[model samples]
Target: MDSTEVAKQENIQRMTSNENTAIVIDNENDAKFLMKATEMQLEKISLGKLAQQKGNSAEVKAFGKMMEDEHNASLTEIRTLAQSKSISIPTTVSEDSKDHYDDLNEETDNDFGKSYSKMMVDQHEDAIDLYEDAIEDTEDPKIKAWATKKLATLRTHLERAKQFKDKNDNLNS
Candidate 1:
């Protein structure tokens, strides 16, 4: 079957787990969350690279280029942290991240920039939620600490993305 079908089946199994379901939160779960986030960040960087290569304007191209640099660096940092804990991160990009940007590939020029900025804003918001929920609910110290820090970053990125969107809009108008 297709990936969507596989994902649905996985979700069903995840929801039906006999053990109590807990997110990767707190200090212990930090390793897992970092690995997962790294996967996502890497994909974001990939999208950014694509945007830079084919973007229509200077702003759009710069935005994509910057994301590639920043996200790749962020991924490196998180991966390093995970290594300290002997965690093995996945080598492949996440299906969710791929799907998120795959739909945006058709956009071009100013539209692509605006869309990307909005996407970054939305993604950061979701990341903040995930981090906050896990940090608040998990008993694991490692997960909590990591989530707390990550939440802070997500919030900052969300604001930055919104500002980028506003600037792009103003310039276009």
Candidate 2:
């Protein structure tokens, strides 16, 4: 082929490759977001239930109940979104989360309230960051919207967790 024709063919190939790459990246991003969100939800639910059953303080139990309820709703929303996208969510909690659960389970009742409250503070902060990242990174309008909505709730949860931690600290002092 002539030089001009060869150059044109190369440009076309590059464009096609870029388009394919974009699709693959989008799919990978969607999958990662869905899986991470699902795992977070499961961890929250499991830990929250544990707190509800074993917490020494009324406040801790209430916080745990709130976590369970909110995370369950969030889970349902994300599951629907994943289904629409044809993504499969894992049914089990991650091993890292399981280890945390085991650690919490080992704590005595007197210590459990403080330990669980502190965990809630840390986990909620992590969750808020994750949702914020999702809102910024997701190309899908539906996922972005969902993340935006969830960000506010995650912030609220974090604020509540911090309040609990501060209250516990004050009680200790």
Candidate 3:
């Protein structure tokens, strides 16, 4: 590889490893929060698109569309924040996320909606926890503010997912 490419790779490694002292985000926890948030966003986008195409129910499809749209917007905000902080975020979902998606994909159409709703409920709950932790733990005001701002929306999503899961379960039963 060219010297420039090598230098770039090294920089990315330092940033990702939280070893770069020159970066705006100096705290390891802040960096971890940003990276984890990015991964969640990517996974949501992937699963959302799948639901859009594979969901058997209107509610599932609509929820998927909401995930796609809202997460896409959130991702843009995250990207801008990461860029400003000189942090590198993942461009794609992780292998585990892909595996989860693949497993969800194997569900039959009749069960897909119920399974997807359950997944959403679970994911949103996890996301709420993450955001809540970030809001409490981040020392950087920008990161803290971002997390705080997103918390309510995440809560709303969680409630919606719960409602959907309940309705989906009732219908399935």
Candidate 4:
């Protein structure tokens, strides 16, 4: 009747389908993993939209579009996974993310690209760490697989973010 009950039922159903061999992992951990992943993706999507609109460089705008598109797709996949597991994830960005966005939104044109790229670099690093932790900690095969699959993309994003940051740094020097 409650979420935990719902999650337990779903897990039982899934396990029964895979041959009655009990798979005992903490459902709450899976839920928390999904929630955190969702929040991170939402923040990236919001910041990506902002970058596309206000980025001072063509590269920054293009990167923003890529982030928006890729992260949106990732978010959808995450949502589907959460639904299959009966786990609920947050639908909106977190307060920290919103505050960061607001601060970035106030940057001057000359500093916007640099600041945005730097934020992306930092956020992507954090995302990479999150996914790595998930992959290591999640006992559910599906959740682990999802984290593993996304980890590669997150790394690529970090590399791109670093490149953008380097370019911005060079421009200012």
Comparing 3 and 4 on TM-score, the stronger one: 3
Best by TM-score: 3
Residue-level lDDT for 13 in candidate 1: 54
Candidate 4 clash pair list = none
- The whole-model lDDT of each prediction reads 0.67, 0.80, 0.83, 0.83
Q: What does the lDDT read for residue 78 in candidate 4?
A: 95
Q: Model 3: which ten-residue window has the lowest total lDDT?
A: 1-10
lDDT for position 90 in model 3: 74
Clashing pairs in 3: none
Off by over 4 Å in 3: 1-12, 15-26
For residues 1-173, what per-residue lDDT tens digits would candidate 4 score against the true structure?
A: 43334544665565455642433246656766787788888989999999999988889899999999999999999989999987666777777788999999998675988899899998889889888888888889999999999999999999999998898877762
Comparing 1 and 2 by lDDT, which wins? 2
Candidate 3 lDDT over residue span 27-64, tens digit each: 55666787888888989999999999998878788999
Model 1 TM-score? 0.69
In candidate 1, position 47 carries an lDDT of 77
Against the hidden reference, what TM-scores do the models get? 0.69, 0.85, 0.86, 0.84
**Which ranking of candidates, highest TM-score first?**
3, 2, 4, 1
Span of ten consecutive residues with least summed lDDT in model 4:
15-24
